[model samples]
Target chain A: MDLRDKYGLLIDDMADMRATVRIQLADGGLEKCDQARNVKEAVQKLSLRRYDLIVCDYNLGQGADGQQLLELLRRRQILPLTTAFLIITGETSYEQVATAAEYAPDDYLLKPFTADALRTRLTRILEKKEALAPLYRHLGPKGDPVQALAVCDELLAQGSRYSLDILRHKGELLQTLNRSQEALALYEGVLQQRATPWATVGKARVLAAGGDDTAAKEQLAGALKAYPNYLAAYDSLAAILEKTDTEAAQAVMEQSLAVAPTTQRQRRVGALALENEDYVRAEEAFKRAVEKDRTGFFKSHDDYAGLARSYSAQGKVQEALATVKDMSQYFAASPALTARQAAVESQVYAKAGNAEAAKAALQKALQTRQGGDLDPATQLEIAQACFTSGSAEQAKDIIRNLAEDHHENDQVLAEAQKVFARAGLGDEGGVFLDATRKRMVKLNNDAVALAKAGELDQAIAMLTEAADRLRNNCQVAINAALALLMNIHRKGMDTSALARAHHYILQARHANPEHPRLEEVASFYRKVAPPGTLILDDE
Target chain B: MDTLLATVIHDAKNGLATLGAWLEQARAQTPSPALEEACRQAQRINTQLVELLALHRGSEGTLRLAIADHDLADFVDDLKAEWLAPPQSTITVSWPADAGRIGAWAFDAYQVKLVLLDVLRNALRHARTTVALRLAVEPGGGIRFTVQDDGPGFPVAHSATMHDQGSGLGLSFARLIAREHRTPNGKHGDIEMKNAPQGGALFSLILP
Candidate 1:
């Protein structure tokens, strides 16, 4: 709700809206209308009463804007499909956002519209919605997907007037279900009719999902060239760029942010710019991310940490330290996150001329590290801090732990090597790293031997222990997951064993999202679980 | 300069909305012709403001169309309901039954309404008794809208290009918008103004 003291325009706008709506309803022999001045009041009224139409002004002075409010309602399914939302905007810029948004209002009305214009638009939209009701029943915001597809086929069979609308909905639902080929055919049907940006972008997305990146990129380029402000096109295009070209990905991410500064998109922009070592842009983007995420929907503690890292990259040690403190205020202290924060503090202190403070911060980080299985990323972070603070011996232990667990990850191994090289222990590091790798290999092989001997429970126990030790090591974690899967197969799908398999798969998937072994694990999951069951990675 | 003009127009439009609301309240309470007239004038002010804003946007290239297929008969009836008040002036809309059963056509409904509303308001202002609007689908899939008033025709010696100083801007705005309503095939709409042989100002818009 708005806390703004200036209520003049708001009061006037409410009066106008009420009068116009009241009269229009009166003409149609209907009554019982109320006008709300802010988002909170509107939401409350909406919940308590069933209204056929809402003429919401885009700007609500503060808190959520009308688009955000509409998004929240639609996502939460608080607004029924029959409730027509007509967004009213004072500036044309809102149209860009409306066009870009995935869940837009029924229509947009420019401000200073007469009561007659409002009536005309309201009447037309109601009629249109009435005409599209059958499709809405099958494929609206809270529609049943299977029924929606069935209805789409039925509508197509009957040559329904809303054939194009149903076609787009069926395409999107099919895309969501990973049925890219069928979705592609539908999108192609739309493209045959018109070069609409949504259809163009959908074709690109389907192609990308089908692993035809070259064609996908060309389709995306066409979509972007046709409609520069197509937000989803920019995002899908950026995801493609992320795999092959970081700089271009940064550009596409920036363009998307220009249209809608979603926290997730801004975070991606910050991360991609940081990958390019564009520290200034990274800092700006992270700042925007942190600011926009203040009310916290898709926000996380990492956004603040990202800003601190950007500050540390720029040698703004004081700012970095303050940012970590700010992070503490937002996220409650936890053992693992406390260690990560201390590690960040250590990095900031090491950048300044405070060796003693840096050493103390390392002590704080290590004290927390004693409590839990530190993920390889946290280990690497703490190790970097240790090396920066003149404690190479302490840093070597964390690096060795990471190198042992992550030996199969080229990206992690390279990053670890750089840490060792920077600390002037390049020659000594190879011996330590090799010893750790050999030990981890032996441990893995011993578990396999136990399994081969039909000591399945022993094998599961050994891998469970290894999982705690390796934590964020994808290969080792996947092996642990495999052991659990074997137990599920031997024990006839016991609930406890299934839960363990599910847990390890989540950590493994998060550690390396695109792990090649995912196909193998997915096959095992299919054998052990029901068909159509959602897994962590799939979700 | 444009910004200042827009701000003034915005304020005027908003003020008219408020006045319209107050007039509606007054009419609901007392049901007087004077309050009804006030409401009508407020609506007229809003319509004029809208035309002026469109004229401004036309100067820039920012006035985008919101195209949709509208039933020609339904649209004409709605337009009549919107403009015609009781007993002051009468408006009648008709279409030929021989026009190949025209169901619907794609056009910017709001823009078309604004353009035609300006013409109808001008006709209402001058007509002695009745103004008529007719819709006809041309043989080539184009549509024609004709608005004629049974008022004193355009001053006898008035040239076509020279708009009457009073109704000049509204008619000009209507012409600008009619031309803007081009079909997807790139065929443009056209506007014509004349003094009908029956002695009244006639305006027609043809869209392809």
Candidate 2:
């Protein structure tokens, strides 16, 4: 009696689940299974336990529909390999939506289907999934990527029924291993089978990584031309061009946003347009992103800040101020984000012609940056605000430091050029950029020469001195780490030198995680020094 | 006449599907031969209703399909399982081995399933012993789905007689489905009904 009272609702839910999966066999026989009634309950059940199959209805009454739920499950990697997720749709529109999704359901069942129909389809899907289960099992919760590569190779060689799937998996695994060459060959093989957009995108990425930008660009352009709505081609193409051709990147981004305007894509397009200095487009994009991405986990204060910048640039000072006020409401007060917000606020004030208020806000922004080590991007942001407020000396100092530190970094140099161009010091800024870059290169070269000449300690000493002198310059810091590693190789693990090596590599990594040389140098630390050091093991 | 026919068929389909759903649900809770009979009969009615509606629309040139892609073997299995009860041990599915890699082809998977269901139902009902559903890639470039049965061939005036009651109209609907399957190479699909050389009724949807 108490069980009924406690679990009456649960029993009802179980019954609903049973009905969802109660597919008909021939002669009106029912095969028993379970499914949740709605997306919330489905996600809940899925997270708690993995079912062998899920048959979801397209119209789930309200909230997220089946396709959206399926997308979420795939994106979050919540669905198990053994599970077959099928979406049942009563309308043709759901079919189009399912097809358009990057991660679609295993199969879609049209409505008014008999139970036998569903059972047959489900059986076929489950059998296929079973055949590929070994590959799936290897890539599961406790899986290792290195070991998974071996599994991929074994399955690939054996040539199972899932040979094609295994090949795709191997290609992806190879890419993850940073072995782009092998991945490129596999992707090319797949493209020969079918000009699948995903395979093309993979080929483009491998090409881009290998420094064949022109070929990568041609491949990406062909895919986009064939399937204009394929978001991966647009995104990968935009990402490559974002470094060198901001305007083209922004244009491709806008085209992609038209196909499927996800909030994440919207924020990306906004940032890119802002980078390209297309204020009108940036304002609309950021506003759209902010409106839709309020609850999005990927949403950041940068979205609101970008919107405010666009608004202020367009001379809509009130809207810019309001955008900042809204940003504060969305995010908690952190020193870094707070500082960025104050800088945006000063820009709004300057646009409104409030000299005194702008100066005060600029001072507040500077105070926020004084105690903390602001990132180069943040430094640039604050510097832009300082320049707008006519604090020429402070603005020039910030840009000079940023320019000297990251003169060779494409992303930083591009942004730095914009800053210099905006301040009407365009040609002078180019000359300054050259001089600073030359000086750093000379120092780096001198240190490396000392290391090569077998004066390892002197090289290490010189680099460390230069690292201290030129703060936040990752190129110098990375060189300094290399010198220290060479010193270790020569002197045999001097604790002090090992410690210094750790300090600089960590600093370099923290400065720019995307640096190509980062993992290369850090791997050497593990080779020379013994295990149990935090630096070697931490990596 | 067309308006009345469409309205009645549409309503009947809705009723039959609703009936089929409830009966299937009831059978799951407490299954019986009687409930299964009711469900099967309701399915037949639903199939007839869908056929009538589609045939009428085809005649008026109002029929449109949500053409998408589906795996051929899976599609055949679904038809076999749904339309054949005891699923007939005599009934088997065959396709050229390499045609298995045909993987997925563009078609109106659901509606085409309906057309094949009707054709297969007739074959199963009439077959003496065996019903074979064979899939083969046509010599030129298209795919063919054929339902053959060792059954007494149709009467000489079959279409003339069956057309009166909209039974032959089902064939017309099947033909319409084939024609709607337009390929990028600008070829339209076709359907043929003929007596097999080895003594059987032959029905095929030749799709580009």
Provide per-model DockQ scores: 0.10, 0.13
Give a tens-digit lDDT track for model 2, residues B1-208: 3488787776776677677789989999998888977887887776667766767776885555544445665666566555554422465534334445666565667788888777777777677777777788777767888888887755556733342245566676688778866542246789877788777778888976
Clashing pairs in 1: none
In the range A43-139, model 1's lDDT, one tens digit per residue, is 6777786666776777765556777778767865678776667877863444345545656677777665666666676666666567666667755
**Each model: TM-score of chain B?**
0.82, 0.79
Deviation in Å, model 1, residue A482 alpha carbon: 14
* DockQ of predicted candidate 2: 0.13
Interface RMSD of each: 6.6, 6.6
Which pairs clash in model 2? A24-A115, A24-A116
Model 2, residue A284: distance off in Å is: 3.9
Among incorrect, acceptable, medium and high, the docking class of model 1 is incorrect
| Candidate 1 off by > 4 Å | A1-63, A74-102, A107-148, A210-229, A241-276, A292-302, A331-539, B1-5, B19-38, B51-88, B94-208
Top TM-score hit = 2
Cα deviation at A423, candidate 1, in Å, is 14
